[model samples]
Target: MKLQSVAIFVLFLSLFVSVFSDTARTGDWTPIKNLNDPFVQEIAQILLKEHEKQSDEKLSLVAVVRGESQDGAGTNYRLVLEAKDESAATNIYEAIFWDKSFTHFKNLVSFKKTYLILLFYNII
Candidate 1:
């Protein structure tokens, strides 16, 4: 019947919009540079250590420094990290924020915001 066909079409349209709309609004977050600073490296090592503690598999990590701002001759940095896990991904995120090595970064709040997106999947 036409009514059934219309209902199915509506459902498919809604699903398509829901899946693709987020990607359209927010561009993909890709790594710009590998973290090379000793401090940043320390944070990464801590995260990897935590991952190893939780799971036996070797963990892979990618660090991306996205933005920098200068105010009153002071520099602030925003970094995002992508971590892989076969079991729990959220755990890796929590460990990074809680770890002390990242404390010196003046913009932890903004950094957390950028990194949090890793928890969500973006279809593009």
Candidate 2:
């Protein structure tokens, strides 16, 4: 009976660890292609095209999108802008922040910058 109880306790412990560990790992950065968001995918492509045009202080683009604690409406439109350096990121941030449409949609925006933009739209 003692051996059986020990086995059952071990099984429960393993299950608990697996569930919690998976949740804890969700915030980590994943590959840019893992976004799988059509809108974000389009934006990334457009940004990549523009990035190619820069000869100096260039921006190397990677479009990575991720949400917060849950897949709720909170952070669905999150996209991270990684650039060649801080200046590149800042420049990109400025372009997005000053765009007329986004300026009008400012109320719905979670935050905006050349380096990062989390629009109101849902990613999924």
Candidate 3:
């Protein structure tokens, strides 16, 4: 009985470790081709185009949903920005916020260049 209990405890410990270990892994963001929704696809394309313009910088576009109220009126977007240098990331954030597409959410999420780089560094 003691041997069986030890095996069960070891199994549970391994499961716990596996589940928490990958929290540090960074997820890859790939562009979705031929999305059924034209609106979402258009946004993605715009973000991709902006990213392409910054070819000298290491950047990627990621789609995410933002929310605040329980009614869920926050905006969804494909954001393109640098993940390394704080200055580059800030430039990208300013450019995106200045862009007409993201004018609405500018007040919602104060896009900080340093924040994104730190976030990516932490994840990786």
Candidate 4:
């Protein structure tokens, strides 16, 4: 019975992965311990707090910029959040971005580290 249950669980997991394979590729996000930079930390805390207050759904802030970008200057930093789907992404954007408090997200990033936040959950 134990072995049979284990096999079933594995099969289910495999099927789940296969179903969302394409999304896994483009919107792949790595879970992490933390982002060490003080500025990024500040931004993340603000976003997380707002997300929690606005919705019951839990969301994660994954990477704060993709590709080969510089650490502090020149390159723009984009904050990527891993959403369940497009609707979640849209809601997050609407609830947070449209608010006046965080309206200057990109500018705030630039001010802190001369970077930009190309934030969007998973528009694709």
lDDT, residue 34, model 4:
49
At residue 11, candidate 1 shows an lDDT of 100
Instruction: Estimate, for each residue in 17-97, the C-alpha lDDT of model 1 and write its tens digit.
Output: 988775423233333244576766655555465556556655556553332222232333334445555654522232322
Give the range of the ten consecutive residues with the poorest summed lDDT in model 1. 64-73
Writing each residue's lDDT as its tens digit, candidate 3 over 1-124 gives 9999999999999999977774433332234343445654455445545544545444444332221111123343334333333244423331221223334542222333434643543432
Q: Compared with the true structure, what per-residue lDDT tens digits does model 4 show for residues 1-124?
A: 9999999999999999988666423233333324456755555556555655555545555444322123232223334433232344422222112112334433323112111233332334
lDDT: which is higher, 2 or 3? 2
* TM-score, per-candidate, Cα-based: 0.31, 0.31, 0.24, 0.28
What TM-score, to 2 decimals, does candidate 4 have?
A: 0.28
Note the Cα lDDT for every prediction shown.
0.45, 0.42, 0.41, 0.41
Task: List the candidate numbers ranked by lDDT, top first.
Answer: 1, 2, 4, 3
Q: How many clashing pairs per prediction, in order?
A: 0, 3, 0, 0
- How does candidate 3 score on lDDT? 0.41
**Model number with the top TM-score:** 1
What residue pairs clash in candidate 1, if any at all?
none
